[model samples]
Target: MQDPVVEYINRHPNAGWKADMNSRFSNYTVGQFKHLLGVLPTPKNVIEDVPVRAYPKGLKLPKQFDARKAWPQCSSVQDILDQGHCGSCWAFGAAEALSDRFCIHYNVNVTLSENDLVACCGFQCGDGCEGGYPLAAWQYFISSGVVTAECDPYFDDAGCQHPGCEPLYPTPQCQKQCKDLNQNWVDSKRYSATAYRIASKPYDIMTEVFTNGPVEVSFSVFEDFAHYKSGVYKYIKGDYMGGHAVKLIGWGTSDDGVDYWLVANSWNRSWGEDGLFKIARGTNECGIEEDVVAGMPSTKNLVVDSAVAAEQRASW
Candidate 1:
């Protein structure tokens, strides 16, 4: 059978992107695919007042920019994380971007725990895997702090072992202790020194990514998005599914003369152009430019002093 999303996209050759059913969503029912769209609108907060920076005067952004190229040292920016069948994109987006920022600022790679934010951030962050607010995840980063992957890791994947989708997964229980008995939960937590929303202007967001690292953005996901394959994605057609979150790494103009934002999705490498897609830029086509959130990770927190370590060891 022909996939309508792919068929419609193919009918228009100049759409600047292609579509096909041979994707991770090929067998996923619409209901099942919706599980990944997990970002909710965060209410106006003080975070917006703290802009990453005022858009600099005469600042020229390159026509082609990609974060992976700029920060080869940062492995998080390069890796495409999977959200599995869980709607924890909100947590994944924030966690992954902060992980990238930690490496960018400190020159050391540390994979912070998305599990901490997903399972731990309470009602203020929204309903966890069902859906969550991006800003709240950031607030949790500073307030409660997130542990390293070794301490928690992502547990949602283990529950989604089949190719077909299962019922909506509930948020896992918060684990105050590390998975490994030897690790101290408190000391393993990584804190962010600061987190804030970037100004909604195109260049301001660009400067934020250029100077620091990747940022997390939530956007309106349409039905057509599930079938995207290559080129720059613009909402060509489809019913509104829900709000979705992803990592924004860079921006560039595609060969079709369409300007696009380079984004990394958490749907795994087998999906959507190797887990990365370029969406229409500057226009906020999917409300992407409006909700960029990132922060300066406190590398100091990643270090566990010998005194604290000894105390934890003795207590254990």
Candidate 2:
């Protein structure tokens, strides 16, 4: 049934990757896959851009780098999230990266809610589950800010009673109230001081991640990506599915000399190589090099509350 993905892999043994039907998306329609990929095309910038930080001359980037290994203290970068059946990858990506930066820059582990952005960002970010611009998600972070997931947990995987359990679920309502009866929204929100696109060059992207932390990126996802099982991935065969946003964790060269970008997907740990995949790097594979977005976490409207951190540390 999913022979095409395997056929392509078998024909290209040196393709540096393999595919299988482990995802159970074999029965998924093209529309279903496309709908889950939420990154929309880039529109005009509505936010501030920061100058790329300059590094020391003759700086040498490590041949291998992984955010999980580099910053083991920041647990947020190690978590693999599930976006479920929703087209909220853009929100998920932006929120995830901002959360990591909060831990890296501020030394606190706070998991920001994609639900807050997906439901509330509205036109500024774009349609919640239908699709959205990656840049707009970061812009929304600067303006409206987002709450902690503990305050506004994702609803997609909840029971059938909740609307999020339905297929192609309508966007959740933009409610500022927290799920916990005790917590309120206004005080729980976290802000970003700034947001911007990284220059599309490989060195520029690599340097940004290597210097600060992981960043959010949107890339073209093809059909064959759905069956990815293991190894450094390079698209071998498939129709264009849609744009997918993910957390760019690091970069490295495979033993075979293939340069790859280490990415953390929002599709849960079961979907790929333990909820992560390596895409061809330096080649702008699938437009991965384009539309990179990230932000510096801010404490302007909110603080990285210690009690909330205690709760997160317990739950996480």
Candidate 3:
């Protein structure tokens, strides 16, 4: 029997979109799909307090812009990362955005630790792996700062290689200390964001990505998205799961001339187009254009000496 998800995809007419059944999520049940995406509800209070930056009056934006192609040095336009079976997309999205922004600001390409935020940002960000809020995660970055992936690498289901390291999934105890499975520790002060901002309007969000780099965005995910292979996705039909967060890198038009937003997901290279996907633009499909959040890296002088000195000593 054909999988219902696959059947649905096969039946749907292509309206500038296509779905593939060969991907990993083809057979996942609605319940299972929902479990994999763990974006928590937007705390009304936090959203209300988050300051919005308005684009300067009448500033014209180019018809198209892609951070990856435009600022290749700062963009981590690499393979899609696998979050395993854990619900750490929220942490990954926020951390990845900060990583790219830091590179853009300082010309250094360092993979910031998503595990650090997942296991240490505390309850304020959301329960590690189980779920989290992107905004709260960014706020955590500003206040507590996270370290590099070299300091604390990500290991969702494939338990850490280090002998004494405990697996962190479903839910793990928050440990602010930065250490690898090998027990070696890195100073938390080495890498951390100093400030962040919220961009609610579509233009403001676009400007942030154009001037800065990628920004973290959360949006509603439906069952149909699991089979997304290529083309601009526009919510054909399916059960609305919770929310999923990703990094919005840029925007462009498809060969058919459909406007789309370029986004990077954490589902690894096996899913989507090499771990990247494009959604319809302008109309805010899936509420992606809403609730965008971004942050600035700490000043070089603030932690450069400490970070460089530590890197020199440990070669991280």
Best by TM-score: 1
Candidate 3 per-residue lDDT over residues 27-57, each given as its tens digit: 4556655766879996776566666655774
Put down candidate 2 lDDT per residue, 238-288, tens digits, no spaces: 888889999999999888889999999987777789989999999999889
Ranking by TM-score, best first? 1, 2, 3
| 151-208: candidate 1 lDDT, tens digit per residue | 9989866547666645567788997889999999999988876778888888888888
**lDDT of all predictions:** 0.83, 0.82, 0.73
Candidate 1, which segments miss by more than 4 Å at Cα?
A: 45-53, 163-167, 304-316
Candidate 1 least-lDDT 10 residues: 307-316
TM-score of 3: 0.84
- TM-score, candidate 2, is 0.90
Q: Estimate each model's TM-score.
A: 0.90, 0.90, 0.84
Error of 3 at 201 (Å): 3.2
lDDT of 3: 0.73
Report the lDDT of model 3 for residue 153.
75
